[model samples]
Target: MGLKAVLSKWFAAWANRELEQIRHNAVQLQQATFRQLIQQAANTAFGHDHAFTQIKIYEDFKQRVPVRDYEDLRPYIDRVTHGEANVLWPGKPAYLAKTSGTTSGVKYIPISKESMPEHIKAARNALLSYIHETGKADFVDGQMIFLQGSPILNEKAGIATGRLSGIVAHHVPAYLQKNRLPSYDVNCIEDWEQKVDAIVEETYQADMRLISGIPPWCQMYFDRLSVKAGGKKIQDIFPNFKLFVYGGVNYEPYRTRIEESIGFAIDTIETYPASEGFIAFQDTQQDKSLLLLVNSGIFYEFIPAEEYFNEHPTRLSLAEVELNKNYALILNTNAGLWGYSIGDTIKFTSVNPYKIVVTGRIKHYISAFGEHVIGEEVEQSLMGVARQQGVDVVEFTVAPQVNPPHGGLPYHEWFIEFGKAPSDIDAFSQQVDQALQQKNIYYTDLITGNILRPLVVRSMKPDSFINMMRAKGKLGGQNKVPRLSNDRKLADALADYVI
Candidate 1:
């Protein structure tokens, strides 16, 4: 066998062993270890902070750390952006994963090799769980597809120069490299402009069995592939393409178009990917994803959604976290971020201590549709509609907009990009509306009041939204398009979002 093939085999075996060990440790030592992790952070980092130290000295310890928001970290981030080391911990971070900030300029997030284990473990577990849950791995070598930001590394050297996705790509074990489509090594080096051409050039001939990435961009690439193959259809291009793996953002808007263009239904897997680390992945037949690497290398904290929005919210330790509760995620990782809120909301689906569902962004609310649809609700509704339609989609997203009034009432708008074409758009929309009504009572009430109507699907050129997000300085080599924007500013700023 070739060296790459041999490495792939060896690495897969090693990764599986590691996952089993992690799972055992998570179940066995989770509680005490989690507590120890908190104390360690306090002693190593938090204790050094004057404010935190003062609280400790005063015997005024709160059950949780005072809640932190992005704004709260601005001073530290400013220091980092301007080349501040030792702002949060000792030593300079190995790299900064540049991502966008709300109402602010760019954020250069710190990343380190110490944090690599959690990120790598999370990724590996995603596939393992996918296989265990879907029973697909028993078949032929399942080809996997990853739809993500271009893996291109920054030209400059140092942590500040590398994107999170790029850094992860760089560290992917060489053994797994053999199994990855588009080869992470190759994809991680090419510039964005060269990527589509590269994908079109290679993937057009690939018998791709698995696909992964953000939904919009995936749709865009497949659309180009379809056209290049003279409308041969996605199935024809990659008949082996059986599963779609997606994360980084919601898949509602682009699902319909992706399935339509591909001319067939395909199984989809969703994950919660963060620059700080990969946190969760869909593992069971149920809608919720299993927390894959809880005890891998990071200690987690949760701030209630309500408290998280407050000026000074408090966070809960993992020991205090419970099920079916919405909370803003705070993370302390080996990467050196302490009490850091990653700006996402999540909920535990069960009390078993190892599964979660990403609920929404702290501030992403959709009132245009009167649905008040957040990320989690939108995902549930989209999946419901897709299952009802017997549609297996690769990727999707939902954007609420003011529909041109038919009778003086604004309607909820949907900017849909899909791979498979459903037989009926209006019928499909009604189905979506029904699903949302069932998923969220507020949305149903809004629909009944005519404050919002069923979703209106707006067709755009393939990759329009993905390009738009990139243009707006919102997306980069590794980040994703924001799921919900109240004004549809992203929809209008196509040139800027795409570049």
Candidate 2:
């Protein structure tokens, strides 16, 4: 093994030991984090407004701070953006992570100096943990690529502003700098398709091993690479490619097609990262659940998903969270976000060391008939049937079809793009609908009670979703088609491409 690989193994061992300590003392660490965040931000404007100085415990904090989304916190964020000192966190934020919001247009989430290191560290520790468990560090010596937004930053109110991925691109650790690709110039291309082409040209012949990105975009890159290699599988183009790291969306939906593109199965790591904080990462190959970052500079709260829309929902801290129940995740972080709801929902797989799986988004669900079907349920249902039928799904989305043109009964509409269409598509659709009904009892009641009919599947043509996203100018960089929507906004747009 090379010197770099040897050092990686040693570092992984040391990091794993520290991680074990953190795992053992997860609750205490979170308690300490809560105290420190409150103490340090006590002088900030929000702190004063929320009575932070008088707060002594989690109960006090909870009573003083109500759960807030971006709109709720925008007034304070506006002040910070206008160069006000000590508005959110102490002094000014180091960077503002600009992201697209559904209702709020654009959001500038602060990445404080104190909280930024944890983001970088958590990602590193994920890889180190993998190395420690698998003892596979040779990939560290080969080319690594993280398909992401441009590293270029534009100044917003004198603070660097860009996508969270772009800001992180600027902080690539020195040791891995030499092994990272495609060239910085190529990464700066404004268009994603052009950037992928550039990336393919630059790294197709290199010893590329570790490939990282959101799954859909990774699929795009693989498609381009295959075409460029005259239809060679990704593993043939870069035999050294082993580890597949992904986040931002569930991988199960894309796993079959992605593995097929690579021409074989490979080890994969799933991470749960957002502009707010690095929440969790897969620590073990045995369990797909992500180990929640309890010791990280963030305090977590959970409101049961079903109660999220209630007038006053019950909020519970990490210690109070239970297993197998979906919760709308809330955050209080060193970045000065207090009781911030980032819109994602998660379910704990294990509470001992606090491992969780991203269930879906709080806002991204279908309930047209009062039968709420979440992202996890839809994904699990569709993928389960797809596995049974030996079908490969390229992409899919679900939305309620409240009005039928022929005045037929209302039903859920599923737009699916398949790599290999099932011979009997009607039978396939029936299986998927039945799977969803089994997963959600409310949906079953609606179907049997004549309130709704079985779901209709619209098999889409090749590149249908890709064309839709491109037409909407959201082709890449953390933008994803919502798995399910309560309304027909996405379904209407997708109607143009249905086969």
Candidate 3:
């Protein structure tokens, strides 16, 4: 092993010890985190308004603060954006993470100085944990790339403001700066296609090993690389490439295509990161579930997913969460977001170590005919059937076709872009429909009662979804198509690209 690899192994060993302590003390750590966050932000305007001084327990917090999404929190966020101090957290925020929201348009999430390190730490620890477990640290010596947004930041009320990934780019630890690829100039390119082209040119011949990004964009980079290298597989171009780090969307749907592009399977690390805080990361190769960061600067609450839309849903603290039940995740972070819902649903796979798997998005589901099918179900159904049929799917999305133009009963419409088409598309579609029905009983009831037909599969031309995203100006850099939608907005838009 090289000197850097040896040093990395030592660091990983130390980091894993700390992580082991956190895992063992998960409940106590969360309780302490909750108390600390409350104490730290007690003097902020939000805290004062919520009567933080009087709050003594989790119940007290539950009674004082109502669960809120970005819209409900906008008034306070607006004040902060305009240079108000102590609106959310104590003093001014260190940075504002600008992200796109469906209903709220653009949202500016605070990243306080106290909470910023948690993001960096969580990301770093995820890698270190991998090295500790797998004893693979040689990747540290080769070129690493994180296909992400521009690093350029614009000042908003004297605070740095930019996409979360862009903001994170500015904080890459100095030690890795020499090994990071796609130079800053290429990273700053605004247009995604131009940026990918530039990245391809810069790293095509380099010793890439650890490549990280959302799966779709990473696939794009790999595709561009293959073409530039005259159809050579990614592994052929960069023999040292070992690990794939991905988040934002489930990697299963893209896994087959990604591995095919690389000409071999690679180890991967999954993470659960959001603008609010770094929530969790995969801690072991044996179990794919991510370990919730209990010691991080965030206190978590969960509302049963079924009860999320109720007038008053039951909220459970970390200790109260049960394994296998879906919960709408809520956050009370040191960054000053209180009783905030980021709209993602997760299910715990293991309670001992507090490991979880992201189930779906609360808002992103197909329920036109009373069958609430979520992102996880759709991904599971399609990917399961695809594997059975030996098919390769590049991308896909599901939406309810409430009113079919041909006048059939309402049904779910699947828009799929295939890398390798199934030999019998009809049979493949039927199998996927059956798989979904098995996963969602309500969908089965609807289909059996004739209220809705089996899902209709619409094969999309190659690059169709990519073109749609490009048209909407959401191409690349953490952007991903929603897996399921209740409305036909996306379904109708995808019509133009159907083969």
Best by lDDT: 2
Q: Give the better candidate number (1 or 2) by TM-score.
A: 2
Ranking by lDDT: 2, 3, 1
Candidate 3 lDDT, tens digit per residue, 332-443?
9999999999999999999898999999999999888778898999999999999988899999999988888999898888999999999988888899999999999999
Model 1: weakest 10-residue lDDT segment is 55-64
Q: lDDT score of model 2? A: 0.94
What is candidate 1's lDDT per residue for 1-499, written digit by digit as tens? 3444344455555656665655555544445444544444454334456344434311243433454555776676566556655555455567777666666556666666566666777776666655555545521254455544545656323444555666676677665565666765547534554676676776777667777776656766787897889888898888767777788766665566677877886777787778776777776556646554666556677788867656667667655677888888887666556667788888877655457777778777676644557777766776677767775544345656576545655665566555454678778878877877887798888778877666776655555655666565444345555566677665566423221
Clashes of 3: 0
- What TM-score does prediction 3 earn? 0.99
Candidate 3 residues lying further than 4 Å off, grouped into runs, are none
Against the true structure, candidate 3 has what lDDT?
0.93
| Per-residue alpha-carbon lDDT of candidate 2 for residues 1-499, written as tens digits (9 for 90 to 100) | 7899999999999999889977788899899999999999999999999999999999999889999999999999999999898988999999999999989998999999988999999999999999999999999999999999989999988999999999999889999999999889998998999999999999989999999999999999999999999999999999999999999999999999999999998999999889999999999999999999987899999999999999899999889988999999999999989999999999998878888999999999999888999999999999999999899999999999898988989999999999999999999989999999999999999999999999999999999999999999999899999999998889889999999
TM-score of 1: 0.76
Tell me the number of clashing residue pairs for each predicted model. 46, 0, 0
